[model samples]
Target: MRALVLRHDHASQPGLVGDRLIERGYDLTTLTVVPEERFHSPDVTFAFPSAAEWDLVVSLGAPWSVYDEETIGTWIAGELALLREARDLGVPVLGICFGAQALATAFGGSVEPAPFPELGWTDVQSDIPDLVSSGPWFQWHYDRCVLPPGAVEIARNVAGLQAFVAGRSLGVQFHPEITAPVLRAWLDLDGGTLCARLGIDPDELVSRTLAERPQALARTAELVDAFLDRIALPVG
Candidate 1:
């Protein structure tokens, strides 16, 4: 099978999610939207590929908001169009954080600033424990998703909607692909100051992520399997 992984920024690697997909026999083709040099000014014109070419699509998190067109104006519309086409073509999508916000917007929902940011490992209330678990998932986002029409909410917490399912697509507000190196890469950017502003110690966050690596790997694997077996594949 083939999987198209969308890496929104230079720092956002596919991490464990990509690893699991590889282990599941997928040939991944990752497309990086914003290169490291262009991280400061991210408005770039990118032509998204058609959704019909891939068996699965995974959209990773980004530091930008989906509603902030002024900063991502050149490519956000194209991405949304790609997502819509993916949905229409029955291509399964796994959207994380900013990608989730984009998925929601593409399906007639909206993205807005959360009452407060969720910036660390936190547990959510999951309706389907077998598929979407109630977990201490890593989070690093300033916005929340208002679920699209016909979307069944799968998980949530005080921060707002955490995970939702619409057709063959699953969008989650947290980052299941986060790793210590990924966290460090994000910190190398302006994330360190953002953490300081939120009273989050970057070092501690990295340490916690390192410590929880094993469990995170297990959870991510299970999530990918569930998405494939229950959502993506046709029933026998």
Candidate 2:
């Protein structure tokens, strides 16, 4: 199988998700939306697939808000269009954090800045906790998604809905795909600002995350494996 990985920022790496996909024999085609060369101006001008070409699409987290289309321009529209196309084609999609907000917006739902931003290790409530575990799932987001129409709430926590599944698509609030390298990059860069906003110390969060990463990543890999297996199965 093949998968398309849509990444918005350099810090938000696919981590265990990519490793699991490779293990499952999925050839990944990664699209780094906000590359170093185009960091200042991320241009999103590409024809979205009609799903006859791809098996699955995985949209990763972004530092920017999904609703800030004015700054991002028509690229946001293009992404939303892609989400709609994927849904119509019945292609499985896995959206993480900002990507989840984008998916919600694309599917008639809305995204707004939360009353309180979620940052750092947080707990989550899930019917399938084993499929999606509770804390210490890495989180760094100011906005949250309202469930899109026809979506089933899969997980939640004090912060809000942690996960939801719609048809063959899944949207998750936490960063189950985070790795040590990715975390380090995020913490060294934009995390300080996010930390100050949350009244947290960046170094402290990084240390805590490093301690928790081993087990957290293990569980995350397991979850990715399960998700892919579920979607890869043939319909009878």
Candidate 3:
């Protein structure tokens, strides 16, 4: 099977998710919306492939807000169309964080600002621990998604909806695709700004991420494996 992995920025690569996909013998083709030259700039252009080409689509996390298509340009709409096409084709999709918000927007769902932004490791409540467990998952987004129509709510917390499944697709609010290297990159790049806004010490956040990453990333790999297996099954 082939997986189309979406990378919104250089820092937030698929991380552990990529490794698990490789182990499962799935070829990964990555699409970078914001290239290295415009990594900090929000002028992202997406050349989304047709849904029939890939067995599964995995949209990674991004720092940008999903609703700000004014600055991000028409690429947001293109991504949404691609997501919709994937759903229409019965191609399973796994959306993470900002990607989840994008998936929500693609399917008549809405993205709203959260009362409290989750910026570091935190535990969420999950309905299916066997598939999507409550976690000490890494989080960095300020917005949350309302489950789309026909979606099954799978996870939540004090913040709001954390995960849901719609047919073959799954949208998760946390970063189950995170790795220590990716975590460090995210911290080195965007952690300071979030720290100031959230009134958190950047150093403390980094320390906690580094210390807790081994276990957190392991669980993340497990979650990814479960999701892939579940969606990749042969249906009647």
List, in order, the clash count of every candidate structure.
0, 0, 0
**How close is every model to the real structure, measured as TM-score?**
0.98, 0.91, 0.93
Top candidate, metric lDDT? 1
RMSD of each: 1.0, 1.9, 1.6
Residue-by-residue lDDT tens digits, candidate 3, 1-236: 89999898888788777888888898999988887678667776667889889998999888888998777777888889999998888888899999899988898898999888888888888889877777788788889998888788899998988988877888999987776677778768777767887788867776777787677667877787888778545456
Model 2, residue 7: displacement in angstroms?
Answer: 0.6
- Candidate achieving the largest TM-score: 1
Candidate 2 residue pairs in clash (backbone atoms < 3 Å): none
Candidate lDDT (C-alpha), each: 0.92, 0.79, 0.83
lDDT of 2 by residue, 1-236 (tens): 87988888766777888877888788998877676656546555555555557888889998888888655656778778888898887778889999888888888888888778888888788887767776568888888899999888889877787888777788898888876678778877777767787799877777877888778868887778767666434456
Deviation (Å) of 16 in candidate 3:
1.0
Winner by TM-score between candidate 2 and candidate 1: 1
Candidate 2: count of backbone clashes, pairs at least 3 residues apart or interchain: 0
Point out the worst 10-residue segment of candidate 1 by lDDT: 227-236
Sequence-dependent TM-score of model 2: 0.91
